[model samples]
Target: MLYVFLSICCSVIVSILLKLARRYSIDISQAITWNYSMAILLTWLFFKPQFQNLQAAPIGIYTAVGLLLPLVFWIMASSVRVAGIVRTDVAQRLSLFIPLLASFLVFGEALTPLKIAGIIVGFAAILCSIPWQKKTANRKVISNAWMYLVVVFFGFGAIDILFKKVAAFREIPYTTSLFFIYSLAFIIALTGLLIRVFNRKARIVWPHIMFGLILGVANFGNILFYLRAHKALASNPSAVFSAMNIGVITVGTLVGVFVFNERLSLVNKIGIGLAIVAIILITLSQH
Candidate 1:
């Protein structure tokens, strides 16, 4: 339970850090690039996952995911910046539908009646939650932000599938696989950073580097505490899964609305209500 709480707090903190970054007009790509280096160091120092027992098959999956991590992360930061944390967080959590859909398609899992209903309602909720600004307002800004949320939803779901694959691969420990993933991610992000520098689109900013260090700590802490929660609640992993999602949604929504004054329409609020119901139905369907 302690671990669960810590994980939830850490997850919310990462979002908060991103919010702060945007508030300060910091270049998120640079921060995210530096984030990988910090994450790798923390993974090595604490997790100490063995790299000797590496397997080629799992490495391929991790490398592929590593490539997507930074790209999706940048999109997520953009989502939070434009769409606000509440909508972004809800879309991210509801991404479970993708893996559920993939399971039905790939593994021939039974799509129970409730699961089908949940998928339908879950998607409706996502559509509703998007901030559809009036034409009188900034239409392009609103539309672009909403699209970012859509990308984040599917992007995270794909990453979740890779995580499932990593978990299933018993030949290599997941921690070691994560180390490799982080290493790959670091290389990828560094390359992106260098490209930006060469193109003169961005400059080496000291403040951005400092912000990245903070983001890196929070980002890695979120993962570290989440893994710890699973270890502590191995008997009932669903508890961690449910609590983590709900907690983040609840906390993120509050922080977005209260702290940042992010506005949401009545329909958007209803979408959040339905999203919770849909999440429970899907989780229950698994059993």
Candidate 2:
């Protein structure tokens, strides 16, 4: 239970940090680049993933996740920037639908009634969650936001599937795989940063580094405690997954509305309500 709480808190804090970064004009790309330095250090210290273990791990999967990670972070940053925390969080939570859809199509997994209902409701949640308005300019803002949200939806889902594939290799330690993923992602980001510096498009800043370090710690804690929750509830993975997603959406909505004063119309509220229901249904269907 503590693990669950910590995991949810850490996840929400990452979003909160990103929200604040925008307000303070933090360069998210640079922050994200430095974020991996902290994350890798933490992973190495705690997980102690050995160098010898890497030879057996799948390099292709690591590369894929590595590339996808930085790309998705940029998309998510865009999501939080343009869409607000509430919509971004809900869009991410509802991304569970992507893997389920892939499972049915690619893996030939059978869909039960609960799953069908969950899928329908999940799409509803997406449609309703967008910060849509009646005015043309506002609608255009939301319309562009939907594009970012959709990329977030599928981008994260693909990343999720890639991680699962790495996990399926029983011989490969999860920590070792994560270290490689972050390492490769760091390389990619560093390269991009150097290019930007050469073109005079970006420059280093102390505040962004500070924010990145904080975000990295929060990001590491998010995964660490979530894994701990799985260990605590070994008999029920579904519970861990369901609780984490629902908790983020539920609490994220509160913070966005109350603390940040991000507006959510009536339909958006209803959509969030259905998202909770959809998560439960999806979890039940798994069992």
lDDT of 1 at 266: 93
Off by over 4 Å in 2: 134-143
Candidate 2 lDDT over 38-136, as tens digits, reads 899999998998677556879899999999998898889888877889989999989889888989999999989999999999999999988666325
Q: After superposition, how far is residue 19 of candidate 1 from its true place, in Å?
A: 2.0
* C-alpha lDDT of residue 103 in model 1: 93
TM-score of each: 0.94, 0.95
CA RMSD, predictions in order: 1.9, 1.9
**What is the C-alpha lDDT profile of model 1 across 1-287, one tens digit per residue?**
78878877877877887778877989999999888889999989998988565545466788889998999999988888888889999998898889889999998988789899889989988998888774235333455678889999999999989888888988877888888898899899999889989999999888999888888888888888888899899988878887888888888899999998888999889988888888877767767
lDDT of each: 0.86, 0.89
Top model by TM-score, which number?
2
Q: What is the model-wide C-alpha lDDT for candidate 1?
A: 0.86
